[model samples]
Target chain A: MSASHPSDQDRNESLPGEAAARRVVLSVDAMGGDRGPATVVAGISRSARKNPDIDFILHGPKDELDRLIARKRGLAGRVTVRDASDVVTMHDKPSQVVRHGKSTSMWSALDAVRDGEAEVCVSCGNTGALMALSMMRLRKLPGVNRPAIAVLWPSRNPQGFNVMLDVGADIRADEKDLLQYALMGASYARNGMNLARPRIGLLNVGTEEHKGRPELKVAHELISEAAEQANFEYVGFVEGGDIPGDRCDVIVTDGFTGNVALKTGEGTASLIGDLLKEAFKYSPLSRFAAVLALTSLRRLQKRIDPRRVNGGVFLGLNGPVVKSHGSADAMGVSAAVKLAYQLAASGFQEKIAARVASAVSLAQDAAERGTETE
Target chain B: MSASHPSDQDRNESLPGEAAARRVVLSVDAMGGDRGPATVVAGISRSARKNPDIDFILHGPKDELDRLIARKRGLAGRVTVRDASDVVTMHDKPSQVVRHGKSTSMWSALDAVRDGEAEVCVSCGNTGALMALSMMRLRKLPGVNRPAIAVLWPSRNPQGFNVMLDVGADIRADEKDLLQYALMGASYARNGMNLARPRIGLLNVGTEEHKGRPELKVAHELISEAAEQANFEYVGFVEGGDIPGDRCDVIVTDGFTGNVALKTGEGTASLIGDLLKEAFKYSPLSRFAAVLALTSLRRLQKRIDPRRVNGGVFLGLNGPVVKSHGSADAMGVSAAVKLAYQLAASGFQEKIAARVASAVSLAQDAAERGTETE
Candidate 1:
């Protein structure tokens, strides 16, 4: 299956050749996560200072947001504040936010992007809420039936990153959704990583044709067909263990299973590292040995930390809604902001739309051709 | 819910006393894997030699099995090869063998324990065939509705092992099956590990009460009720990350998801470790540092290797059907033999049957008593 898009050959000129291509896009949800505006403001402030070429829009209670950014003088000029009275609580019901919190910090942030005031939306809060809000407000890209939440994971290799999608967007997805996810993932790789054909894997129980539940079986068939039409490369089924390996560039699965698997991997990595640390501290000799190997251990720790790739982009939506980790700190939030800026800068939306449209078109063409032959 | 049967006061037999109360008994399936009967025979010969008290009844094609052991004349007399003309072929369908090949090597192995020819049945052949044959031959322990495959995972923690059941028994299971899994897992902990009150957890997406699919919701209610009855200590729901951390002694889940999660964790661990090893070989300096940490790395590898704990006993069956790994070698087959012997020694069959019967009886009793009280 093809992972690269032939259509992409003509589209990359927008980056350097076009003078206005670097225009800063995307609105940041200030009142999100444990610390809310304080951390969000700091993260955006850091990104803005690092890269003066980007613009930002912070959405939250005007007075509260302004108060948090009061000390950071120039951030207000670089990024505008959109007045929003309400903040969606961390534990707020996903459906409740979509139905009742239209004027909420999260909704307002996404709305700005939907209205073309910004190109992407960043939030460290409810992922389900962002998914619902984005699809409802901005609408799904043409020909894309379902949206997905894609996150960049720190790969086992030092120089690489693994993109895993449908993190928690849809619980029970059809084959069409899986195909859409692959297209979006491949688009991200080509546009962001410049890979000609990104290796894409279906996150499954095993590599066999009949390994997983029925959804995977159907997804495999559709993905293979989609790849045959040159939408994006479709690699075979990949085990959950292969996520951090160099085996696949993009891995896709239904949200529920993906969420559990991702979290488990995170938890296990941290738990093991911590256990080893404690074990090394048990005796003076081991402690001395740990000190000697501290540099190597730190490098290993840096390779697996979740904080390295903090944002999970809600792909296939009309606009980007990068969901920052719930327990994200200042550095994690900053990393997320930078990722949001890249998603906006990389022309991810346009690339995804083109490839997804082609995939859908191919499906329709197959059906039309079948009828004609009949 | 209660994970084990009979209260702590009733089953507090000391380790020494319990050790004296048991005798190692194993039934060997003399064929399977790449090496077939040769590996099985070698493993049996090695284990019996290592543990003089361990006894074995080798059930298979007697003439061929005898030739495999013909070179080891000293140990040949210690092993008794029972002739079974019909042998379960790896290529044969699992259901077909159980339905027609009742005199096959696998069936005869399970039959040895089922009809009291031996205490435990060990098979390196097809698991489905053994599971099916064991059911038809050994009567189900009363009140035990469905059998589950249980494996003890040695975690990074030195405290104790974690018992995970239903790796691939029932594809989809309801609350009662989960409840039975909890009971069976708890029995292993209390009896095997000598834990006074082993902690029990349901494998889930999250810790929230309302979290999880429909099956988990119902199972949660039943598990809580059983826990309140003091059957086995229920430690509440735990996530996938908790497996390697030893957060709970027993974890219960549906077979399909459980199997995926188990393999995923194992794969990820190996993948990460291998990546680290390769990275360490990048430079001469890094390789030197790795040499210094070789002991620690080897210790970690030994702790996480899947092959080290390859055998999983089919719990809730009337008799034993120990399923060795499909990739089993001589060492793995030897491990399976040891596990089968231990299961018989622990009297798991009778213990689990009584536990299942009592729970059903109590539930029915409460239902009838409520009618009178109301």
Candidate 2:
């Protein structure tokens, strides 16, 4: 909250709002998720009714969204549809959508955020496309090398879960990019987790020097040196298990590995659930046991619902962008809509951008000075 | 069973009664698991009693094993320990331990298997050290270029789980290693799952050839070519989610990525379990509901237990080498021991080695011949 605002903050303030109490959070690319706009409409409609303080504008195919809205008249209360023909499907290549399919829902949604029509833009389109679009349209914060997607995985430890960045954004990375990811992740944890100055960990196989591939080893050095100069806590190294445990709070990894771990976590959770059900089917007696355990199972299901954590915040962009989960249903979409509004009103984007820019500049200056000494 | 054996098998089998059904499966570092040798003892004792067809030589600290076994009279039966003070803890650097600690339980264990005192060797110690010892003592299969670890992950399809290979063995992998992993994984599924010529899928980010990193693209080409000349079916590329949902019977990946995925899966499952308990704790009514649902919950827990899965079999070695889960308890260690025995009795080592040798030779010859055309 003490951080200085960007140049555009003044512009945004006059055009729309600041960290205000209540406002509308417009959503773009409503038809971007697994179930398309219907689910998006359902989520936002529900969210709108639940949060009377907020309003909604769904951007997508007018006809499809309208017909879907007609089916749920009660949900149409605080929601309105802004028709855009483009709908990004799961099968569409990310580049194709970004470079060529600009007319799609994602772009329209991003435009809403850009023009101040929407306080926040949210979509579950291709992660790469979303990153590219948000960065290209909204622009990157000063001193940031690139934007990143941050996901909070459920931790097994008593301490809360850690935030992992660049899940599927930068495939080819360097030590510099990794440093930025750490700073961005830390800034996110600070705002998202409400930490004063969060701890950041570089995800690695081992803690020793030269432990990972040449690039990662160097990245570790850079992050450690940068963290020393920055205001946040820098934990030396974290293993795979540490991300989901109390071992660390902010995990930094390349997009390639991060994406693999994130998706692997998702798939594994699903497998465990399915496998547990099958185990109960081993015999009639076990089946009866499964019935008895239904209440615990339901609670567990809610705790790790794929839908609950559907939105991934695209950090380091100029404005707020919430990337919806790939398989988000109505509830997931609705929650994401509320999440975007909260993020916008919470001043998350401005706060993170200010902190990251300041920290990164300091790191760069320190690195330059170190080189000069050498 | 029909294939030719690798060089290690040939060297080991030269000893007296080495090929006999009652051969001993020597575990060098049996005391390394979290639960110590109790699990190993149970596994070895259980197999000896059930089959009346095998013996187990525990090449570890005899006094320590005795001290523990003294507390459990019934399980101490059918297992023998060779008093060896040397140990290789999980944290020991692999090369350092192998070079300086050759007399360690790990090395001694592998030595037993190598010198023909045991038919196979299983260890729960430092995995890297075990791999080094296996390779150093037994040597790589004549034509086999690399060794890999294969474990079956529970999938969603009614058909059950799928086998994924090379989960953290080699670091910088080439296409040939992936192809070999695929072949080895298929063999395991055929024997372990009783599936005839199971389907094989490359654990890739996408179905397209250019989807993954440079290495994967090259690996995909080689795998497709290898599949054409192999005995099993090659299904094609698969994403992460495919592993849990049984998209294919065999999934292949380089060890680095595989290891992260496996651990993430394990963490996710545990995280869900914790979250469920937390959710239930939210209310007194929910607590009662959790109790009522305990039956189904237990079934789920039983289905996804890492202990049930036990260990990952290190393929491409001269003999059957099972690496128990790093965090294995007494029960899991015991299970891995039984698996090692089963691998020996089923002649899995001989078959794998032979197949690997022939396949490697064939692949090499083809490469040499094919390069002429290119």
| Chain A (candidate 1) TM-score to true chain A | 0.88
lDDT of 2: 0.70
State every prediction's TM-score relative to the real structure. Answer: 0.84, 0.86
Q: What is the C-alpha lDDT profile of model 2 across A336-371, one tens digit per residue?
A: 766676666557777777777677766676556544
The stretch of ten residues in a row with the least summed lDDT in candidate 2 chain A is A1-10
**A178-264, model 1: which lDDT tens digit per residue?**
777887888877665567678889987667665676667767776776775554678789877777777788888877667666766
List TM-score (chain A only) for every prediction: 0.88, 0.87
Q: Which residue ranges in model 2 land beyond 4 Å of their true spot?
A: A1-25, A52-57, A63-82, A156-161, A206-210, A277-295, A360-374, B1-17, B21-28, B62-81, B157-161, B277-295, B361-374
lDDT of 1: 0.71
Best by DockQ: 2
Across B1-374, the per-residue lDDT of candidate 1 in tens digits comes to 11221222232222211223344456788875557788788888777666555566787888888888886645555666788888776666667986798678887777777767577778877666777777778867777778888877655445435778887776667777788788878876665555667789998867777677766776776676676554677777788777766678877987776666666666566656765776567667667767766666665655555566768878887766778876687788877766665566567767767777778765445434433443
